[model samples]
Target: MATSRLLRTSAAFLAATALLISGCSSGSSSPDDEASPGLTTEAGAQRPAEEATLAPLPASTPAGLRSYYDQKLTWHACGNGFQCATMKAPLDYSRPEAGDIKLAVARRKATGPGSRLGSLLVNPGGPGGSAIDYLEQYAPQPASIRARYDMAAMDPRGVDHSQPIECLSNKQMDRYTETDQTPDSPAEVNKLTTAFRDFAKGCASRSGKLLSHVSTVEAARDMDMLRAVLGDKKLNFVAASYGTFLGATYAGLYPSRVGRMVLDGAMNPELDSRTTNIEQTAGFDTAFTAFAKDCIKRKNCPLGTKSTQDAGEQLSALFKKLDAHPAATGEDRKLTESLAGTGVIAALYDQRAWPLLRDYLAQAKAGNGRGLLAFSDSYYERSPNGSYSNQMYANPAVNCLDLPPAFTSPEQVRAALPSFRKASPVFGENFAWAALNCAYWPVKPTGTAHRIEAKGAAPILVVGTTRDPATPYIWAKALASQLSSATLLTYDGDGHTAYGRGSTCIDNTINAYLLDGTVPPKHKVCK
Candidate 1:
């Protein structure tokens, strides 16, 4: 769910040369140039598309945002012993009284004698990650932290249980996940194009009226409403990957309301879609280099190559082989370039998965790709029943709304391929085309790339992992430099996020900040 444009810069290279570049803060409008409170077809009626952009409230106090956060929430028991609630927010903030949309909220109250620090709202990076599921399955904080805070989450607008977005059926989704991300020839390119078209059509047919309204800015507004309704004096949040962008947007829109915020694996909001793709391509290439460097030093490197470049060449050859003849998984599934790439990408997210990736690649080299195929299945969140979740569907719905597509034509992308390849030779081609997903999008973007200068915001902590694949390390530095009151925390590790992933130093540092309103020293590095 993270918006990645593959870049080839290594974490070490970025760290050594990281510069504090000023982010462009100009106010830009949507491309379609539609006026505010525009009307669009909804269900059976012509309803006004929610276009109210609320200015920050007059009061500078954190409590001011909460005073406006007034709403009645109806709670119910839902999913895995968590208490879920539905709260109504205006379809458009411009007209708070016009009509309301329901937000699905879930929470597990703090257990303890510790004084409460208020609600700790959390989002797990996916533009489509189920926050409620994250809270239930992954977020088990220290008793000291848990006992003092009400851990909570919401399925952001258009996500699961919150007017969910559905694009493809089980059959269609399987085909989609199998669609070749890396197209090597004219025929492959045509196949990729058709896949994109079919995927878009499925979204159009299923999501209907909801797709247009699922941008990041809108989701940020939804967060504000959730904060208000939850009776929080200020927004306390922990967001990773794409969620970092959401939190940053919140800080930009409502600077004074930010409280105890942590943006892990921060995204670079300053980059346009093209640059984003290029940088991410390079990021994957860099990660691949790291993997290759380590793999060659191991006893069982499948490629048996002495140098990283040779390992890369070997992998590329393997992809070409797969392009001609996809490997069978010994099950109903098969391994194509796209699925294989996804399997590699899944390992890139967490350093812990590197061993598994090595073994999977070894199996794949033997013409038995079941191991890699299984890894890809987990990354896609495919179940044994072949029923896939709506993560990918909702991912694009939200992303397309957040920013405009990088390029609208394959020709334009081809023109830029040289630069993209320069940035990340390993992943440039795939990411270049992936950016085209929004080209045929049913809805138009409502925002553009700009510097987030939350001039009056509280001290926001921006955490960056040294070798994060989804959100490259430079993004953390970029975001920190852009924000007026941001403190950058560096984690020299490989993963999408640093907190709660078994780093005592990272966890303790963040916990101290959240609990005591303490900001880490500028350019603080934690190993």
Candidate 2:
């Protein structure tokens, strides 16, 4: 599983749950704005200067790619001050003449009393997450920054609107996600592997040729093209979770064009797929331990108010029970151990969902699976009507193409079980199995683990939550160290990413960077 799933799924789960529960749902460089540095104004006023400016292609650009760089975008108003447009990119960069594909783009112009600082591209991980969806529904950029930059996003190719990869039908996906990740018997193992193979075959049958070309390297190239089409001399971006990899790839590819980037919940490009999954398993363990500590402090904690070890054992016990007899949700769906684990893992992404986790756990312990099932559904991007977004399809399409599979066969996973279980007693086995999906991918791997050193890039801020469940904090430290110019900002807190989830120190420091080109001091730490 791509670690980028941390931010998008968890945040979407939070928003969806809030609707189920409550049913609800920048710019000023003036003396007044100066007095209140964070205040923002309406962007309704027209700024003719915001019109598109095509950036010049680099002198070394290949002749075949010149047209892409020179293409002009005609944006049309979508809704709520947002503009929508489409961009054309090569289906296969090596064979540009073969075909072209369209990428969906969205922009919300700067609301400003200050001169525009160009576009600020945003992406919220997922390898499969919709950048446009994030830009419209979730980005929490401060007013000061929004006032000076037109917030923009491009759904990476093979993602949401970018000619997404289609895999299994909704009914098939339901079975795939619930397929046992922890196989006790050979028959169970065969079932699991068969599901994975089916998923891979489904993608090959539907998405076909597109699968081979959706690698991160290609996505980064697409982003640079996006920057040129937006007329920005340098690309200014804020990417989280899997998006960090995309941003880092961009930096590695176009170091000279790096501008004001913030990679929150950053990923380390140096690790192989197995190591990534193992480390992510450890991350979830860390997050769950933290949750256990918090849970014990609360009165109705379902795992019992004893030690965290005991809590882990209790949760493990519950999972075992469900493995034998799946808990029935209100609907036809049952909460199997796989879905239950997904639910628990989803809640671990955000501390704000701890109470909900507690409630879900309580309900699950009592045989009601609805709560946890809801979380699993959100993680899978499964709608109430039983349709799934293409996230699962795109996620593996990108991950498998980017790196070799963690395990080539079931025997390999069984061999690694010891290390994985040591890293995460509760989640290790399942994660180890989850990593096996790519082994059955129709396309061979095109990328290998390596360090990314954006040699001449401007100082990039990388934020890491000390207890992030998806992209571990260690990745942030590693990425910051790898980048030629990077500053590590540590949030000694919980949750996936740090920028807009709530931390004045973290937010203020990032706001300064995005607004006034202020770089935070080295080794900055926020509580």
Candidate 3:
């Protein structure tokens, strides 16, 4: 049920107890802004063509895909020192000629005082999050790393600016997100399931042909194609959250082609959907415990300073109160139990947001839900004007396509509730119900839970944040153990990911690997 947004960038909003899944307006480089990769300046001025960086595809490349591999990209001078391009990927790899879909690509070339190493493709989690938005807005890479490698990103298929999947309308999404997750009545459960059904149907109706093709396997294939077009002999990547899964899949499929890859906030591909939800629930509980311990040390802590256990009871009580009598935000939207939970969950992604969560809880306790509602809005990526980016739509599309549902019926969910509650007393019920989302998916899963060894791949760095909420530290350990050449880098800290979040040790270790190919010893721990 947890949305594993890499480096814990922005928290993705999940509706109450259903496994669910950013918003950015769709963007493509304008025709007039297009330029050849090495021939145009960031200011759009003409320059002499430099030697192409594109590495030729292997001689064994299939004839059907040779044209795709041979395709040239014309970069555009996008704002803020980045170039953009559009690349075509087959809609269905099995039948290359069926059609092609356009993938939006963006890069900031290496600002060198050092010789350029190569392009380093980055993904900021969310099988649904937009890489372009991550590259442009988050830009977590340090200048030292940026100076040596072109930081590249592509919006994977069925994601933003890449034939994005569309689901509920803005208003529908609002209602859907606000729906009761901890259904106390059968009628409430039916309503919650109905919302999921409508969401799935909307995706099938609008996204249609693409829904069946947006699996992580296909996205990984797209990455390989991108690596070739960028002219890198091997794929150099830094992927977080769900991106870790994408990166591992690439290494598994094209082991010899992996280069200087880092998988942070790693996902255990071995776990089935049910186990992932349960473990993630426990992870969130761990994060909440950390938050409660910190809160108890502060004056006027909303949950009271009695004890962490007392704090959980108080928070649970608040949720129960909101469930019966919603709190009014300044805006038309009120803070219901689901949104209140989401708002709290959103802040847990990063320690930086703890103060905000404290303030929001204080406000909620005062019967003013404005702050919590705003946090929930941010989590949903709901614009003030009301339109949504395609992230929510694509999250389930990719998830359901990649793995089977956690629970196919309410009976199963009810049966599993006790175990979920044992995992997380506060958030377990919602997360358990959230896992039911894929059950209503239009397409049957194309993937199954399996370990990814990625044998023959270069040494891959696997990072784990001990208290990562969405992707637990245990998952990182599991992933590292599964990958043949992986070096486990443990951050005995809080937050969703380790690097680029003020940890000098984590940052230096990764920078050394990405810059000088210096792999750390096995099971290195950073505080």
Candidate 4:
């Protein structure tokens, strides 16, 4: 299975449960006028030179707030023994009273033998991945753990049933995901640039006004509302990958309401888009090197090289070959450069997937492209029947909303390529281009690359896996250092997220914290 599936499927499962709840009104300022300190508008327009002042929490939050929160929900029974609902929130937080936008929420009450600890909100990264789906599918907490908490998830604004931001039709998505992320020449580069522009245009046309407000900050605030509605005095959360950023933002904004939060596969909110993309590219390179090292020791390694560098060169050559002459899958699909690259990226997320990747590479080299294409399809979440979850579309929408575009244009990307490549010789160029997805985003960012000094927050735990591919390990370090009261938990492993991907030490440490409100000592490492 692809690593994306591991994360995306879990995310989708969480989103599935959090089915439509409510909407929030846009604040007084237009989306473009919102104070985003370190980001530029979609048109590359600079934000007005004014500092953003944090709005004070509502004075003496209404005594009937919980009742109001419940009354706003429209509930329905969903699959997997859960209830789903939709609720309204402002598209812009600045004008909470002006209008309302809908958000999807779901919950499965714990069937427990332990005292209820309150609602435990879960988010599985992607900035766009469905939190409801993760809760429904992958939340394998012990019945003892489940018995003590009501598990809940919400599809962030502009995702899934929460007034979804659709950028393209299914067919267009197929074409878009297949567009080469890595360009080998001027022609290929132009094709890549055009693909990105077309994607942005598609989003603008399809999503219209909705695209302007699907940001992390907005989602974080929505989470606070969810917390209020659930009648929990504090927010307890398990967030992976980009979800970590969301969770961290919540802690920053509502530290007094934090119960127990676990940020797995954390992203550094302090990094600029360029730095983030470059660092992630390097992370993939590190992961690939780990894979290559392991591959060389195995007798059946397809690349059949003694050195990791040689293995990368061979894989690059294979990609070049695939680009020039796409391989036909028996099912009438062809393996293009993008598909091959996707396959490679998918495998890098988990060490267990390495053997599968090797086998697929071997089969592809023999002119049977089915295996590799299957891996790519899995990463894209494209089922054989041609249906796809809204992950890719959601990923870009939320990601673009969270930070400034990595580059303003192809020229800027080209100028930065050498530095990116120097950071990760094998994967940098491709990731540098992939970061362009936000360059033409329909919504302007309302947040920026600033250290989230979550001052006044209770002790928050930040988790990191040394070999995590999607979120580099250093991010956990950076996030912990930035947060005023963060404690870092390290898991020396190879995977996307550490808590549940199977590390007894990691799981136990986190579970103990969640259960007792105890933070691991700073710089705690779990082997």
Candidate 5:
């Protein structure tokens, strides 16, 4: 799964979740911005140049793993009055005694008025997103699932609060976000490359040791460890966005261990970085078209109403203007075209933010950028105090290690511009350049694009939102088609994921499966 799922998926958590689905608003800044510090070149010097492919899992725990799987977990009160526990797993599963990573696990016991089923592990995407944070903040599963099953999650290795990955500091991030992804000239392209290079160097310096092991394959192995420690006879899960990829890996590795699983807003394991980036650009384009179609009906549509084509053209023009001369926001910071574009893209994740996007665009059109900046800030997980979460850092770290670069150089991206522009005239240039990010990654990728058949598994439910900007709906179709015994549930709507977003039909269908192990009929379509 590529980054379009976003750590704002973290930022998008109740954090951006509020901004995204609920249209939650936040205030912008006005203090003087500081210059970014020089990139550190000494952090991950000892990491192997060749990325470490995950050591193969043994058949039946390989005698060396008996202790990890048989260990008892002692749960205690943690965040939000829920139970939390710590477990240990080998850093390199192949070498059991070399070192161990501490895995953080949390759970809310079943609030049952009926018999409790096994635990249901939930991951709200972002290979970098904190699963624990999502569970405590907004818990996407229905209340009935909470009542019938112990709701739980684990922060995947190298993610927030679980030996988190650290890359650039806040000041550098400020510069990084403003660094133009869609460069129009050679100098601009060089600047963009430097930003990505520096960002990569920083992650390498700080997290070389952890970078190679943060691949989804290793994370899926961690999940199996969690499942065993939780005392579940079989794994029952609801994994969304990138989490779908993680869960699918688990099913493929341990098919008989799968119980009822829901893979919502899935990623096609078959797509390489270039294809993922191109498809994601198209996904955002589809979403923008949906937003534009609705915007034209509103009285204050800022992009104007001649047509979706005109709206895109106007939006593109505004981006160009911001690129040349940034707009001032409520904060002392100026909103460069890159930030403004990010703000626009952030809002595109959930159509609920479209009216706000229209209002913010109107503000930007009139020379104010606070609202748009706020959206960008939320997307980047930037704080009002000018601090940042490890999201931007960990996101790149995990993405780089998980897959090979989408484009190896600027020339490659340039060659692909036509296809991207054709995919999304408004957002294509940005996604195209965004694909260039992994090109300069410090660590090699441990994974590759392929299918996850999970052949002997029981029926798995896959949900797709027709107009989802991230994890395009077709991906859900592809994943469902790939998995044997998979059922595709279509949400003919706009947004990222579908289960808990006011869709009674989606919620009920998924709820039935989670609570009763009853998968919805194959290819079920819900509006």
Candidate 6:
């Protein structure tokens, strides 16, 4: 969940876990068309049975899946020092021989004398975040796990380096995001509706068939294929934000395949889009409150006086000011209220960005919006050359397809405005309207908010930061409660996620589990 729009961007309150496995067997036309792959029975051996009940084992893979499970990957030199390879999976699982999609995978080999634990797949949230970039940056997957496990990363089906989803043209996207999210006039509302309709049309035109197939459940199935191609008997994974939902789907669909999974900044799979957005609205409000409390203490704090309430009012007023008169960046870009809000939301993702946000707001108040515009630009993944990646485009595409829209129409959104306002006074109206983007989507939702009881799965660690803005903290609690074999690990701190940000307790706890079989107690809380 890349918060601001990325959380709302990807999470969109869709909770997009509408993954349906149907029978235990693959979705192939004929269950007996081919023999099932030899999946391991080891996950049940050491899995914790703390929950009242467990989900049944997934049916064995069909014979047609043999090529996918038995293919050998040829790793080669890629960017920097990491090894890279291409793995192939069927575009439609129901028709295995119809077509295929290429997946880009990158890995840093285990540098250790300790026994190799196998490949540890990692995802840095963003249903759209480039796992390749994350792995290349080496921001996640700490050294301990790296020492004994091959740190592997894969770009999901409709993400970077894979068969990515592309929507509006660069110019159209700029227009789309700049549309008044908190529309006041009827004309503005219609313009907003057009923006969404046109954007969805662009995706339908550009993405075509891929648009209908990139569900989180399908992505999870891709992961199982990746695991088999990598020659691993069990899946060892580290997923954050939306990735958590993907992992949960995997475990629920293939419980016997889960091995040493960690879901950081978990997303609750059981919550619907509106409920998810409402809760996330409150989550951001909470994070902003924390930031406001800290900001008022600093010298030259920009959001007016010391009270969080007063600070919120000041920020709200500033949004109104920008809504009327957008600020100019050094370039042609203007800081529309939407862009400014994105800037503010981007900074809220990491506590380390607050001081900079304060400075940006101060400059913005002084008629200089370069810094804040830069923040928004980064959030939008817009390049200075007026080019852009498919991140922002794919984020909503995955989100909209995974789960139904939070609000189906402008009327519905208008009706729910009060509830949204109550949830997040500063961001409610805009987010409420932003939630309407999916209403005009070209593709029907493939998933829904459902329980992910990954019964018989190995001990999975679920991490939650108390003040995580993107994926609400309570989401972790809810997810842990839903997963029959999950262990809840709480971090009472600031930031979107809690692992590998210099917290020894959190890192050690996760590392110990990845290294050995030491799951933390149910209520383990770390500072």
Error of 3 at 405 (Å): 0.3
List, residue by residue over 91-210, the lDDT tens digit for candidate 3: 998899999999999999999889999999989887788998888877577888889999999999998888899987888888888999899999999998998898889898988999
> Which residue segments of model 5 deviate by more than 4 Å?
1-59
- 416-504, model 2: which lDDT tens digit per residue? 88878988889988888888888899999888877778887899999887788898887887788878899988887777887777677
Q: What lDDT tens digits, residue by residue, belong to model 5 across residues 1-527? A: 02233722423533553554442221122112211111211111111222222223444766777798888989999866699988888888768788888888899999977898989998988768888888887667566777888999899998887888888778877888888777888998898888888888998898877787788888888888888888898899988888898988888888878899998888877766787777778788888999999998777899998888999999999999998888988677898898998888888877778778899999999999888898888877788899987777777777777778888988998888888888889988888888888888878897877777887888899887777878877688777877887998888777788877767778778888887878777656676
Q: Give lDDT tens digits, candidate 6, residues 1-527.
A: 12225642222111111212111111112111111111111111111223233244346778878889888999998966699999999999889999999999999889887889999998877778788877776345566777899989999988989989998788877877777788889998898888888888889999999998888888889999899888899999988788888888899989998899999999977666776777778778888998999998877889866699999999999888999999988877788888888889877877767777899999999878888877777777777787777887778888888878987788998988888888888988877888888888888997776778876789999998878888877778778888889998887777787776656778888889989979987677777
The 0-to-1 C-alpha lDDT of every candidate, in the order given, reads 0.72, 0.83, 0.81, 0.73, 0.78, 0.78
How much is 114 displaced in model 5, in angstroms? 1.0
**lDDT winner among the candidates?**
2
TM-score, cand. 1 vs. native: 0.87
lDDT per residue, candidate 1, 284-386, as tens digits?
7767887888899988998675899888888877877876788889988788877887777766766666677788888887888887777677666677788
Worst 10 residues of 2 by lDDT: 32-41
lDDT for 367 in candidate 5 is 90
Query: Which segments of candidate 2 are over 4 A away from where they belong?
Result: 1-9, 19-59
Worst 10 residues of 5 by lDDT: 36-45
Q: Each model's TM-score, in the order given? A: 0.87, 0.92, 0.90, 0.88, 0.91, 0.90
Give the local distance difference test score of model 1: 0.72
List all candidate RMSDs to the true structure: 10.3, 9.9, 12.3, 9.0, 9.2, 10.9
